[model samples]
Each structure stands twice: as C-alpha cells, then as structure tokens.
Target chain A: MSDSETPQDLKTTPLTSEHEALGARMVPFAGYLMPVQYPSGILTEHTHTRDKAGLFDVSHMGQAWLKGPDHETTCRALEALVPADLISLEPGQQRYTQLLNDEGGIIDDLMVSRSAYPDTEGRLYLVVNASRKAIDFAHLNARLPDSVVVEELPQWALLALQGPRAESALQTIVPGVAELQFMQGAPFEFGGDQIYVTRSGYTGEDGYEIAVRNEMVQDLWRALLAHPDVLPIGLGARDSLRMEAGLSLYGHELDETVSPVEAGLLWSIQKHRRTEGGFPGAERIQREIAEGASRRIAGIKPEGRAPARDGTVIMAGGKEVGVITSGGFGPSAGGPVALGFVPPELAKPGQALELMVRGKPQPAQVIKLPFVAKSFKR
Target chain B: MSDVKYSKEHEWISVDGDIATIGITKHAAEQLGDLVFVELPAIGKTVAPGDETAVVESVKAASEVYAPLSGEVVEVNSVLEGEPGKVNEAPEGDGWFLKLKLSELSELDGLMDAAAYKAFVDEEG
Candidate 1:
C-alpha cells in the first residue's frame, strides 16, 4: 500500500526501444519507464485484444525461483509463509496466492509454480508484482529456512500474448504452448532458447505468459508482432482489460491494510490451507473462513457513461460504507465499471450503491464480476 | 461573431451575439485521447467562469470541463451522448460541448487568442 513508491529515477525494460519505435507514450510506473498507451490509443487496443490478439510487456514484474532439496521440502517450506496447497501441486501446475502478514494483511500477491522439467524437481517459480517485488523478496528471505534458497532472475523478460486468437498466433512461433492447459506451464524452445511458457495472464483471456532471456526477448517480441492478429498493447489497455475482466491490480485492490478475504480472494486458498493452518495469519484467515469478513470486494457498474475513478466514495442507505479501489470507462463493458470494497451484507448482486462522483451521489449497482464474460480456455 | 478564444484550463469559447459556444481545445482532446463519456450541464443551468460545468472521461481516466465565462446553458451537443469520438475527431468544431447565453460579454477578453494558446500549449508541453 503505502510502501509502493513513485520513483523519480525510472528503469527501462528490455523492450523499451521497441515501444518507443511504436510511438508509445512512456510513463513512470512501479519505478519503470513503461508504455502507458500506443499511437492507436487505449480503446482500439482494448477492443482489438477481445477481437484478436495483443502482446504486453510485463518484464517489470519480478521473476524468481524458490529452491529446496525436493518437492515436499520446497512446497512445505513455501506453505509456511503463504496459505496455498503447494504440497499437492502437480508438476507444471501454477497457483495464485498472497504473502500475508501475521495480522492477515496481504503483503503481496504472487504466482507460484512447480516446473515440469525432470531435472528441476525441488524448485518453484515465482512471479511477483513490480512495485512490491523488493519488499516481497525481503520479507521472504528474512523468514525462509536456511534449507530453501531464493534466486531472483532479473535477466528474464516476460511477454504476455492475450486474447481469443492468442493460441493460433503463439503456436506459429512457439509450437508446444497450445498443449498447455490454463494455469499450466512448461519450458519451450523459442529462438533457440528454452523459455518457460505458462497458459495464464491478467486479462482473464486464453493466453500465454512467456519468460524469455532478456537478450532474446526483443526478437521474440518482434516475431510475435509480425503475426496478423497480434498488435502491441500498452499498459493503458492492459489495465482496462484486466479491470473489465474483474481481475485485481497490486496497489489498487490490495495492500498491507487489505486481507485476502476482504479482497474476495478466498478461492485462492485451498481447503487444506484454510483448515490445517500453519502459514502466517493462519489463525485470522481460518477464523474469517469460519465466521465472516466485515467487508468484501464487489464489481460495481455505474449507471451512466460517467466513470468513477479510484478513491470515489461508496454510499449505502445514505451512509458511507467503502470507497472504489479501481475504476474507469471499460471499453468492453460499454460503460463505466469499477471494483470497490463494501460491507459483505450489501455486496450482493443487484444491490444498489450510491457513488459520490464530483461530490454528488450517482446511482450504481453491484454486478457479478467479469462485466464481460471471460473467454479463458478452461 | 467573435473569434474563438482559449482558456488556460484548455476550454475554448466563441461568442455569436448573446450566445457563446464552448468546447475543449484540440490540445486538450489530444492529451485526453479517446473520450468515452461526456456529461453536459443542463440547458438552463447557470455557471460562472472557472466553474466545473461538465465532466469528460476517456477510457482510462476522467477530467472536468470548466466554464470559461459566466452564462446560462442554452444548448448542448447531445450527439456526444451517442458519439463521444466526435470530440477526438474534431475537438474544436463538431465536438462543441455546450452553448451559453452570455451574462458577462467582457469576460472573453481574459482568455487567450489562437496563436497565444498554441504558444501556451507548447510552453506547457
């Protein structure tokens, strides 16, 4: 939350020159000079991805490895720090979880995966938020047992190919990625390098997130752009797509003050992790699972074309209840869409909400998530 | 008809007798990019210069369109309700947001002329 920094000095991603050549508007985000939009603008890029394919530069997110002697040792070791059923993770499987504080506040949410390669049995792969990566790494290292090792990989560039035609376009370059199911990952050869490819993404679309060597990533990016269905998307469209799809953003939906339950992320915690209780904040988490969280996240659709942005106050029965964490005009949703925390009692579908826009109350309703239906290849 | 004048807030005003037409400047539209929503003040609502008279929203963000001179709203381009893209297409012409019956005609002198506004945009950018 407050730990996130808007750094004065910005770092450039490996694909910075490519983005510049494409006439991208670069902005400082998470300490990186990243493209916020391209010449085509956010609306076109957002709708294009839904109609075809879009490539996103996500190399700013941290990639690392959690290593131990074997599967049980590594999985259980990680299980101690986070609430997830890592012990039962089959090879090539990936799970999304949050690193929680002792008080049940989410320090950071991340992706943890077990490699399918026969030689890499004890190692787990991790992809974390760009802004919280350093903090996550520090929190992880200071507590992890001496037996487990963390190897941060700053030399890798991650590219996400997302949308309905993502599979067709990706198969042309990286052939075996089509075989991977949702949340499954495997190492594949691209440009003579073994890149780890996962069938997962933030957009809630059927897509692949590839981790390629920083040296070879530009080539892969160029090759992907060459596809007829593919166009380079910027962070602007990326956020809109993910928001309309009802996915969470790091600083917006989560922070040290937020709990996974309050963020509506209870599904990420498996039954074993919920009941057995050994991780940090296990007591609080289990108690929330048994009792109830006072507030929870819900999809909010403002009635008219007007958009409600982050920090917009939410009202229920003429009394303030919560505030919108993320909001904007959703190109795909055909109007304004938002996500905000509200009392669990009032977080039901069709529940009416009053959003204070420009200091005036505007009508809204709690709709089910994914303002647009997600096309994930389940 | 008076010449089109620009405000520091990036809104433009052009007076024709008692009625003045208002819209966001081209530079402002370029900065906003792909407006998805346009909320105009009601036709009889009175506004003062520098007042937040309308709301404009792009796909990623939202911004306020301020009143350039004191007036009562006489008309608005309802076409924007169905086609907000027109603002991006021709921000200074067909994309005009509203027409106001002027209450203070001399207020137009305070805004910048085209050349000055262009220089101001350049300096700010």
Candidate 2:
C-alpha cells in the first residue's frame, strides 16, 4: 500500500491554512495532515492552556449521529452495542462510553449526547477518534438495528476551547455557552448557521467543543483566536496536557485486547446497565464487576528528569510485571508522567516499581490517577 | 583552517588541536522540537565512534545522541541538566554536548566540511 510511501493522500482540515500561516510543523496523524507543534513549541503551549485558554482544531475527529423514531428507539439500539447506560442520559446531557467487542474489549471510546431541542429529538450525537472512524462506522452499521440510521457528518468541523478562561472567551461569541456545565450540550446560533456545542473536553480542564458547518468554521476560528486569552495549540501540547491529566488515549490505554474493566473505565458503565446485563460481553463484564480484573491500569510517575518512553517494561524484584503504555515529559506538571498496567497489589498510590528504560532500571512509583487536579467548571 | 566537521548522524565536531567540541547540528535540533531533558556521558568516559553518548528528550518522545568520533569525554555541558531548552536555542554554540580528547584523529577524514554538510542536509531533505 502507498499509505506509508506517500503522505500526499493525507486529508486536510478546515484549519490547515490557518495552521500553516501560524508556522506550525505539520505531521500526518490518523490519515490527516495535522499540526504537531507551532513556532512557540509544546512547552509554552501546554502551560498556557492551564493558565489561559487554548484553541485546538479537532475537526479530524469523527462526528456522526444515530437517527431513529424517538429517544427510546435509538437509546435501546445503542444499549445493545455499548456498555454505558445511554437510555438514562437526559436531554442536553452527554456521557462518555466505549463500543465493545464480543470479548468485552474496547473497540473505540466516544461521547454520546442528546440535543434538548424538540426539533432534533431522534438524533444522538457521537464524536469518535479520527483513526478509528472507519472501523467504528462499520461496526455501528453491522450491529445496529435496521430502524436506526447511521449518519456520518463529514461537512462539520469540530473545535475545542480549553482552559480556565474558556468560559469568558467563548461567552463573547456564543453568549449561551456561559450557562453550560460539564457534559451538557445544546445548539447555538452563529453566522446564520446552527452550531452544536458541548461543555466537555478530553484535556481535564474547563472547556467547550463547538461543532460548526465547514463554511462558517474558519470565521469562527478567527473570532476565537481574536480573544486576548486564546492561543492556537497543536497536537504536541495536546498530548503533553493530556499526559499530565493522566487521560487515556485510544491506542495506548485502550485497544482490542484491553477490556473496559482492565482499562479502569468501569465507572462509565452505570449501575442500571450492570444490573440489566443486555449489552455485548455482558457476562464477562458483569462477572468482572463482581470479581475484580486480574490486572488494572494505574498512574506511573518516574522519579527523575529522564522521561520513560512507551513500551518500557515494568519490573518488580527482577521479575517483569507489566509495560508502560503511554509516557512523556509533562510540561505543566513540571516533570515526567506515565500510565501503565499493574497487578491490583501494585496499583496503589504509593506502590514502588522500576521501569527498565534502555535496559537500565529506573525507579518509579504508582501515584494517583490524575497527576494534576481536574479544573472542570462542574 | 576550517576546523569544523560533521557526521552523517547529524553531529557537528569543532576541532581545537587534538580536543574536539561536539554537538548536534542545527538541522537535527530543529527536527527534534523543544527538548525537555538531557543526559550527558560522564567526564573521562571513553566511547568509540557511533557509540551512544547522550540522551535528549522532547515533550512527546526521547531520542539518543550518538558519538561521532572515537574519543574520551573530557567535558560536558552541565547546564543542560537544569534547563534543556538551551540546546534548541543554540545547538552548536552554548548548547554543545561535550568536548572529547581525540583518540583516533584519522576518523575525521571520512566526515564532511561546511559546504559538503549543507549539500548533504539539502539532499537528505
């Protein structure tokens, strides 16, 4: 395949020109040409998001909707495929869920939201990772009932405004956004087009995601960048910020072999779903809930300046225990941070371990889930 | 005397008699964005050509800095241990990785000079 030989086939987002104008270093990510970093670099961009507002072009992610006759029709059809209790998700509210395979492994993690407006009663919004879009769409089509229609919205672009000042900055453009708490979504009017927005994000900060049509997205991007507190951030800073927050990326903390219970994401499954046991892999999930998983993911903090990269082996008393999944230098945390799988005994906050980096054992300890405090407004 | 020479691995060597100051070329520094950590070889540590002598880490990943010539490490840039951003700012001057006491001066014969190094970088790009 020419996928590796030629990057010319990589897709471009609505903000590609804007990123190029800002002197961003473009890299191919998930079959799309993306900005990895800008002129100011990842370090500054990371700290700025914590102190102020940072705008990110997330249009590369997949946006789609499940349409059925009513809320119950669509929710029940979705409930059969995923673990989360989507039926109880109130109007204008959003919940994080994972699509599971028959073995209970996470196929993809996505956000499910319902619009409060009566005009769009049958539609359920979903935003999934860019790399897994095709696979996820195929899975949805193959599994869902014929009554529910899967509609992929490629004409819309997504943008995330993240940080402490996110509220005030976004309130200036769409005044209704100020009232949204965490996990709440609604439709707002801008540039004669209705934009879908949610007060949620992956960066573990107070943020808002705006979904707008392609035509007005550039205008909206320019308007958001015009804010004094807002600066455009690239994927490099996004990764570091998420690392400090201890959030799991799809390929790292989640994959085909990683179950929801082992991935430490059982909290996303509500009590009703646990009791109902109607979804795929319900037997394994319910059993794991009753009996703990053999191994679980935990937060790892390397005890030195040198950051341990991924695939580094975890050792305990000269025995290999686990492997580091995702790791990097966290600019905002002012040190190195990582996440990995460990036994239940070693998953505690103060348990000590060693990471064999470059064949040399480096001391590390299991800390709390999030290296930094979550600053969500909710 | 153009005492400067460069390696295909993107390291620059400035010769002062038998001692040489070594660092990654500007092209290499630009490619590795915003270094966050640096681990240099200890003083007096001997290394052959192409040996791993240092480690430079960026925010998202880690990379190795290899020795370009056979030598013993006589001095290192200790300032990098505290602040690694200096390497991206001045990769050849203040950000120099180490100074080596040359053990095999003939190893320099296969290296490239200023003009040749420029052409090599362009062709590689």
Candidate 3:
C-alpha cells in the first residue's frame, strides 16, 4: 500500500478501532486504514513523544521470520540479499539494512534481528515496510535457499512505546525490559502471552517495539495506555518525529532506484561487507564506496514559517539542484525542516540553497542531520 | 451581524453594504486538522470570485482558500501571523482571513444562503 495507491478496501490494523475511539482522524496510509492524527493533533502528539512517552501502532509494517537449520545458515541465506554484515550480528541484536536489487538500488529498507527466543533460535525476525511487504516476501522466497523457509506473521501486532521516559514506563509492566540495551530483543511473558520486544525504535528515542499475538494486543495496548506517561500517537506525529530525527522513509528517501550510499545510509554497511562484498548489487555498491555517489542525502532547513513540502525543487544559483523528498514543520525545532538529495559538493553542512515552494524561491541551508539529538540509551 | 453567504469551496462571506468579511467554515477548518501557518492576500489586492485569495497550511497539507466574491482586499487578520492555530480554534471569528470591499454584489446571489449551505455541507458528507 504505497501512498499513491487508491485506499479502497484497505486493511485495518488491530488498533484501528481504538484509534477511532480516541477521536483519531483516519486516513489512507501505506494501503491501510490508519490514523494520521488524534484529537490532540500532530504538534502536541509530536512534542509529547519527545517529552514523555508516546505509544504508536506500527502493525501495518510487515513482520516475518526466516528459519533455517541454524543461525549460521539463516544468516548466510539472508546475507545474500542485503549488504549489511549480518554474519557477525550477535544473537538478540538488531541491525538496520536495505534490500537491494542487482543494480545496487534499494528494494526496501528493513530491520533484521537475530531471534533470541529459545524455540526460534535458528530464525531471524525481519520487519519490512508495509508497502513493499508482498514484493519482499516473494523476493525472499524465490532467492533464498530451499533449506530456508519464510514465514509471514500477519496474525501479530506491533506497537512502539517511545520517549525519554519510555524505558521507565515499559518497566512498570515488564520489569525485565529494563535489562535489555538498545538494539537488543528478547521474549517476555506479558499477561500470560509470550511477546517479543526490542529496545529500539524509529523515533530516535529510547523505546521498545513489542510484537504480540493479535488476540493479546488489545489487552497489552489498554494496559500500556493505563500508564500515566503513555499516550496513543498517530501516523502524522510519527512522520514528524522521524523527520525531526532525520531518518529516511522508504518510499520517500529511498526506492528501487536509490542506493544506500546515495541515501546516506552507508553506516549500516559494515567494514567486512564493504571490503568482501557478496550481496546483491555488491559490485555497484563497492564502486560507489570507492568513487563516491553522484548525489547524497542532505538535511534542509527552510527559513521562516511556510514549509517546503515534498517534491519542492532545490535551487542553487538559479539552477535546479535537487528536490525535497520529505518535509514538514519540525514541532520540536519550531520551524520548517526537510531532507533531500543534492550533489555531493552541495551536501556539505552550511551550504545555502533556495527551495522553490509554491512557485516561490524560499532560502534554505544544508545542515547536519538528526535535527534533534538522539536520546538512545547507548 | 450581516447576512452570511457561502461558496462551494467552503469559504464564507458576510456582507455589510460594500464591505464583506471572509473566512472558512468551521467544517472546513475541522477537515483541515491543525493549522500551522496562514498567508493572506495583501491589502489593496484585487480579487475575483474563485481567486486564490489566501493559503491555510495544516501539518498534513496546504490548502488554498478561494475568494467567495470579487472584491478588493481591504484588511487581513494579522493576528494569524503569529498564531495560525486561531483558524482551527475559531474559523469564523478572530480567524477570519481577510476583509474585502465588494466589487460585484451580484456574486453573492450565486452563493448559497445559510439554509442552502447547511444542506450543501450535509450533502458533502
């Protein structure tokens, strides 16, 4: 369910009814009937997440597992698709990576975590963007060895509790969660159901993404919301939060035509993978790493009040240089901010540019990303 | 209070002889979610019916508020410059976008009256 697709007959997440009950304004997003904002609105919701805890329903994302005879086999099979050094990813640790095509173009960006569950010891839990789930599943099934099996967990619901107080809030319900560090996942019993939890999230805060069975999700959601610090945040705030955090949205900052290097995601590609490349598009990726990409993702801060929305053209000395991929008012920054691709030379911090917004050139500057400092518990 | 007329684009105009006040309907403001910024037409600018007279931007999108009738802009709600959320808080009062000196009073005849506008809004839903 890409944003461009018609929303008719859209799929609903388990929290859909709850969102409506909270007076959320529902909108079609990523092919799902999702809430874009609640009665508190985007600005308040965004600030709430940064100040306290904001719970988000991210079940619309694709969740699945790749199982093999052992961790090595599973990791090796998965390594064939992504450029990330999954072979060295310790058990219970999560790594972010992109699925690339033969040309080094990103098919989708996903989170790959080695399962810590005893029962699923040889499996890797994977989460991909909702819009590309079907294609990702098919791609994995066709490319992975016959010994490995891909299982889509459509019956599970995913929730994120994120903020500066997220850890303490989650600790109230599951005390064992406090033991986990960032990027670590483990299974814990919550209300008699064993749910998987990761101490990491997309919001650039110290948070957790809990995956629970569909039947148990409602109870968990209610219990989590019962906390004084927890509030239900919608997708509108989610985008603003991630944008302020300077994270990339798959379809916006990345696509089948964009590579990780160009998208400024080279950090996820480990040193071993960079030298001994074996994944899809390894040749092109290696070359780009050596010669540098033509265009690089850069942060944009527009001057004044009116925001420069997505697809707004970037102008340098009266010439078109790039286009904004994602842009909006940064509630925390209290001003308009954006991200887009530009020439590597122009991608430097403090580079001045003009954003053609609503047919008018608005002055902007290229700045270092993560507009707000990350609060991860490193 | 003057007689209020509404355009199909969701703008409202309350005529007082040659001067008229313009704003968006409460329903339109609610539909737009939370407004973050507003850009009003400059005073003394000439506008025709259906002209894009103002821009109301919400967190989710930017929308153009069309002129309900042909007129010359005489005043604007400068208060909105600092607090755009006023449009969401009170769309028909302090949130009024601009005031215009009427150039074509007959354009109001093409717009819907209160009862007709109510029916139109209900039909839209």
State the lDDT of candidate 1 residue by residue for A82-175, as single tens digits: 8888988899999999998988889999999998877997999999999999999999899889999999999999999999999999999999
For every model shown, what is its TM-score relative to the native structure?
A: 0.96, 0.97, 0.97
Order candidates by lDDT, high to low. Answer: 1, 3, 2
| Candidate 1 docking quality: incorrect, acceptable, medium or high | high
Displacement of the residue A268 alpha carbon in candidate 3, Å? 0.4
DockQ score of the complex predicted as candidate 3:
0.71
Best by lDDT: 1
- Global CA lDDT computed for model 1: 0.91
Q: Per-residue error at A360 for model 2, in Å?
A: 0.3
DockQ of 2: 0.88
If both were scored by DockQ, which would come out higher, candidate 1 or candidate 2? 2
Which prediction has the highest DockQ against the true structure? 2
Full ranking by DockQ: 2, 1, 3
For residue A114, model 1's alpha carbon misses the true position, in angstroms, by 0.5
DockQ of predictions, in order shown: 0.83, 0.88, 0.71
Q: Model 3, A10-119: lDDT tens per residue?
A: 88999889998999988887789998888888888899999999999999999999999988999999999999988787789999999999999999999999998876
* Local accuracy of candidate 2 as per-residue lDDT tens digits, A1-378: 223725688999998999999999988889999998888888888888999999999999999999998899999999898989887878989999999999888899999998666688777999999999999999999999899989999999999999999999999999889998899998898887889889998788999999999888999999999999999999999988887887889999899878888888888999888888888888888888898888889999999888888899998888999999999998877888999999877899989999998889999999987989999877
Candidate 3's iRMSD: 0.9
- In every candidate, how many clashes are there? 0, 0, 0
